[model samples]
Target: MLAFFIYGCDSNNKIWEVFQEKDLLKHPYASRCGDCHQDIYNQWKNSRHAKAYISEDYKKATHNYSKTKCLNCHIPLELSKGEKPQIRNFHKEDGVNCVSCHFSSQTNSMHGPYDVFSPPHPSTKDEDFRKAFICSSCHQETYKQWKKAKVEKTCQQCHMTPVEKKDLIQKFPFHWFHLAKEVYNHEFKTGKIKDLKVKVKKEGNTLLLTITNNQIPHNFPTADNGKPKVYVFVETFKNDKKIEEDNALITPKFAFIYNKPKILEFNFFEDFDKVKVVIYRKLSWQKKKEKITEKIFNFK
Candidate 1:
């Protein structure tokens, strides 16, 4: 029966194992993958993916899952390239778990970045896992934003940061079977605040501030469902006493897209000793805006 099932699949999508539909369904929990992939699984535990469905912020944002569209990415059955995964009917607590990204129902196997020889569950080589398109389904807007930037770097290049010469699995016997290769972090990464660059110019009492997203490759404070904000605070001082204070907010709608320059002009209309510019950011899930960077420009 399994042999017939294996032969029934598309030639290009065939995996090694002859697995029935139920065979793949047997292992339903994310923790099951941790038995062998201890390190990788541990990293995933600290990731936002782990908190996707259970996040209090997510629940509140979705109005307690009243929005059905939001559930697809949170507890996905299987994520496909170029399309959002279907919502799973069971184990919703797993929340974007291992099988959500790796398992393929079509072939009844785990699809990963590299081919594996395993006696446990079926795994096959899939280069699509190495590309940014795999992330496009859920990060639709950010994926579009990245495509506009026209950079060669994939989402994994920055988010699932690569470290060379590491074994993919850590379990004793599994480690003995697998060879060391380039390993990427399961805990997706975010850009550093220091990577943001600001240039200030003065023309009489007017200040021209050019903020460049030199490193962050996606929209600044980007969000799909929730509103994130970027704030630019401008303060002018005379004799060390503050004279004027102003702020500009960049919402997700009016964002500083990746590698783009956003310009702000502050017309003071009068002389001041110095000006201070501080930028703060609040991500979609954050409770408060955190300081990104600050700079002081002297007009003395």
Candidate 2:
């Protein structure tokens, strides 16, 4: 393997050789990786992973960087190490960049789900990149919930849907020779309430509503920090006149159960002719709850 020394000066003005790997010397920054993998970089640029350190909500919640505990995950180093990575002083703003998950200290190479013949950087295929436990250190609560649910589908399979692409790299010497392949999208979108199943029924003077996390493997609002909530509102009407309304908030806390139905019951007047149930969700960092869906039933 070819190796070279890359010299750079830190804040202290002392020169340091950060990498002895030959290819790494050319691409030290995540932005440099974008030179070839433009599409993946753009997708990551719009994801929560990219804004982990710079998000306004996260900054406000951490009390303007007073909470050191939140820094580890926000500006993580090598995640493949299976430990809480130290916050990087250099490029701290990048937040969970391509190197965070792909870099391997042991092999001193980029680790990925696929074996790639990259001339710009040394790479190795690691199976751990395909597993969910790889994310447990950062997403502890969600990982536990997924484990309890005992589902076979991995986190990447659902969040990073695969697509057919012609080239993984751009402007390379072997670019034209490479064929199309299936690659996963890097957006990493989460928290979809569209697949949830809601059932409502009236029994005597009480209305029962069941909300099931049918498509998700974990809880509806799953996270390690921040208070994500699911709101259930019930309104009763009699003869076109508004009578009474009630609402319940479902907040997933530590040790919250996943992949189960949350049943809510509302008691209404016997003469009530109509009932309306509305579901709303608020992300932990969001200022307001957004309506997901609503159901109206007539008992008259």
Candidate 3:
């Protein structure tokens, strides 16, 4: 429902300051996690999660919400230490630290404390701890949806597969790469042509423009809502005189078609050798307080 991430880093600075206090450091879980899941720990060290607090998006979103309450989830490690008492210092780049869910005391587990001091790191003898709960604690809604759909399989089931996961998990230099990789080409680049051509010509008082959807896998704007419109304008000035001005707007029929190429046609009469055309797919967002112009073509 929320527009995802959109806030500033007011809480981040406070989080680190609060974390430094003696009361907060009473619970030490990060060092324990580093001992067991050393490989995953090392991999996650450079991962996006490791820098969740520092992310510009997370910083902004947390600032807009109630600082005290939101900082608890935003900086779970400081909450487990019980130093600041209430949510305050959550704006630090280390927003979500390793101690968030990993701790030694069993009392800190679950929704209340949101702490787990002693989790089964890979170096620890127990390998069974690498189960779904590790991911479910944060992705509760998604986990619920998967459970209801009876597709709550192992992470490897989907993440390390043939059809969907082939490109991402292949052999590479490092055991794991934080950035996502793919075997198949992206949707936008799937069927794109090597060379694309567009030209316009003049015939007496009229102009002709041609556009080719050469290498596009689908269409120019191959999206859910395909309603596209084109506006053409022509103006002629001769001997310091505004001789004539004409404009035409056209809307395509396949507005709702899922995926397909679209060929448009337009013709207008004016004494000028140049004209302007614009195309729009949808309405602009009200929050975007600016005039947006899309001139498809201009010929002389």
Candidate 4:
């Protein structure tokens, strides 16, 4: 459950609501996102968000699970209103694409920093919609950290800050970086996630777990150089009773050697009956890593 409270009837708030809602398949944005922002359409075509599902990370993460849950964030509009794809098309869909956020039919009246207007979609357009809450729909943990720090901003405050430009289409570009100019516009750079999976096995009250970096195109957490962690955790319970726990932190430097199915073995007393394996994010608040855990039974 989320502790953050959303408010008001605005575009930002509506977007947040859409994120919180379990079913947004029938929303207009899911079908009619290409009407406006033709320029963004071309730019996003080559963006990381567009490639998220096709990326190695996504494939490995959803390899064995129902594709629907993964596609909700990766391909926002694919399964809307009972529409399911015969075969998963990663490149054509997936991730938090442009249409996912700016699907309204409203017009932009204000321009420049702190500018606010009704985005071109049927969704509600209000003050909260213009804030970072919209982006927080996916990056809930980062949003919590930002809220805890009392930062006076949203995800776009840092990720989409406009940069001054004289040789560009306008004076300011919402995204302003030149790292991947050839592949796509530097201004439209979105973060990438690597697939990290953990498998657990049991043998005579003892548990052994392995983790692998399955689908990282660039790196486990992101393509851009930064500090992050890939860690494994073990928690033991005996007949529904708490027993012991252990955690291991792995970094990119360490991952180079231990990238394979790195093994972690755990021994439990005959009294213990269950074990849990958690592959959680240890990266800083800014990395926006997703956390996953698995549990298994052990007979003693």
Candidate 5:
């Protein structure tokens, strides 16, 4: 195979020196990009995206990869804005790797939120890279809910929390040429979940707990193709002694809609003087539930 690149530099144009079209679309691999973007690669390596195809939970759910539809998203070959991705045969182990999300056949270049001249590959400045549609293909429902909420925050703003400015690349020569810009964490964490708005009201022997998905603009505990659950645990006490404990479950079918409230009721004797409520969420892909927010109420 012949390595091909047109070599020239004048601060305005950079002919491909290290990457040819075949190196990108035909022989795709994340490590090739990691040659320069070491920091970003390390962050992505530890993310759920890195394990999308290899996750035990995903494999178990798919019955050892028997479900073909599940494979596409888990080991997507490429991603197009507002469209579901197509599965690739090679590098399936990489799961949702760099090329899956960044490289576009449409543009025949890597798309990002910045404009830059690079010797290794072709780069295109794309506004869609900063928008929610970039994630809409995989996060269908959440994207829909986000649109309904009509907030200004994109999914990246929340999940890909911004980090301090630094060289986008780690290579010495390349690192010095590019200006530092706000870098987004490639780990893809949702960060600290905003606390939900909750209130407890007592009407004598009747107790009501209302939970509102405040501040968040999407459905709480939402998922695209998997079932996610939200649990509301309630406890009642009379003079500091817990007398009753119960819970209500909320699912994606009836998820905590954007700004709407879901009320749960507990009927007890009029003697109860205090109440405690705790919320937990079990995402579709997780085996354990984690506590989200909790509140206590006292009536003297």
Candidate 6:
């Protein structure tokens, strides 16, 4: 799971000294990395990881940043080698930055999925960087669901799939010349509707709808806060007139218990000539429900 990259250092080696500073906040911002890693930094700047602290949705959910508990993951000191992290006061606005994942206090060095000669700053190769456990501290519920599913793909494999890139870093005097390597995408796209296996059926007076997280390793609509929801809308029409409509909302708390098939049942009248079922999901921070899938049934 580990990947390697060469690092070139200047004779003075001022970067290593800064990395050893007690105040990690003093560490360079992601923008600074852009000087050398323009593409990667731009990708990170537009990601949720970059907006973890300053996002309006997060602010609303935490009641204007009053909840100290909610702030921990958004501004963690450093992710523990095992799980969880200690909160830090500095660099609150930076959210989950590069150093948060790369810097290791134990070894006092930058840790990544690489073991290369990085004399600019001490770098360690950590296989955990490529595993899902590294994300478990903040994504506790999703990690539990993934473990239950027993999927082979790690979080990084799915969310941070690798892409071929020629320039991993900008041209620097002492930097090693790298051809092309598979660098992980920092977009972190999750909660895709296409990943779910959904089926709807009519049995007697009950409309049974089944949903399975076929592709996603974690629970559907998973979140630590902001109240994500899954809506199941059912409607019956008689002679082109709407007869009955029923809907159900599945929240994060209940979605976590979705180890088994999420079968939603709705009782309906037999007179209906047609029935329609629609499923939609809204992220905790989203304002509108995005359609996942829908079905229509006709009765003779």
The candidate that achieves the highest TM-score relative to the unseen native structure? 5
TM-score for each predicted model, relative to the true structure: 0.87, 0.84, 0.33, 0.38, 0.90, 0.84
Off by over 4 Å in 6: 1-26, 174-176, 239-241, 256-259
Model 1, range 1-300, lDDT digits (tens) per residue?
Answer: 544564456544545334223444554787878877788889899888998999998898889989988898888888867788898878888798999998888877788888666546767899999899999889898899888888899999888987677887777655664568887998886655575688888888788899888776778877767678999999999888888888999998888877788899988856787899999998767788899888898877
Model 1, residue 30: C-alpha shift (Å): 0.5
Query: Per-residue lDDT tens digits of candidate 3, residues 36-146?
Result: 334435545655445545555455655744455545444555332323323325334544555554433333322221112111111122222234444354434334434
lDDT on C-alpha atoms for all candidate structures: 0.81, 0.74, 0.37, 0.47, 0.81, 0.74
lDDT of 3 at 114: 15
Tell me how far the alpha carbon of residue 95 in candidate 6 is from the true structure, in angstroms, after superposition. 0.4
- 1 or 2, greater by lDDT: 1
Residue 160 of model 6 has an lDDT of 85
| Each prediction's number of clashing residue pairs | 0, 0, 23, 20, 0, 0
Q: Which stretches of candidate 3 lie over 4 Å from their true place?
A: 1-38, 64-66, 78-92, 107-128, 156-300
Q: State the displacement of the C-alpha of residue 131, model 3, in Å, after optimal TM-score superposition.
A: 3.3
Q: List the residue pairs that clash in candidate 1.
A: none
What TM-score does model 3 achieve against the real structure? 0.33
Candidate 6, residues 67-151, lDDT tens digits: the string is 9988778888888755667886877788988887778777877787865544345668898988999998888778888898887
Ranking by TM-score: 5, 1, 6, 2, 4, 3
Candidate 2 Cα lDDT to native: 0.74
For candidate 2, write residues 1-300 as lDDT tens digits.
111221122212323222223656332567777877777888889888888888888888989979988888888877735467777666878988888777767777788877665555567888877888788878887888898889899898888888776577665543543455667788887746674576878787788887777777887778777678878888888887888898987887621255577678888766577888888888766788898888888877
C-alpha root-mean-square deviation, candidate 2: 7.3
Measured by lDDT, the strongest candidate is: 5
Q: Tell me the alpha-carbon RMSD of every candidate.
A: 5.6, 7.3, 16.5, 16.8, 4.1, 4.6
| lDDT of residue 164 for candidate 5 | 96
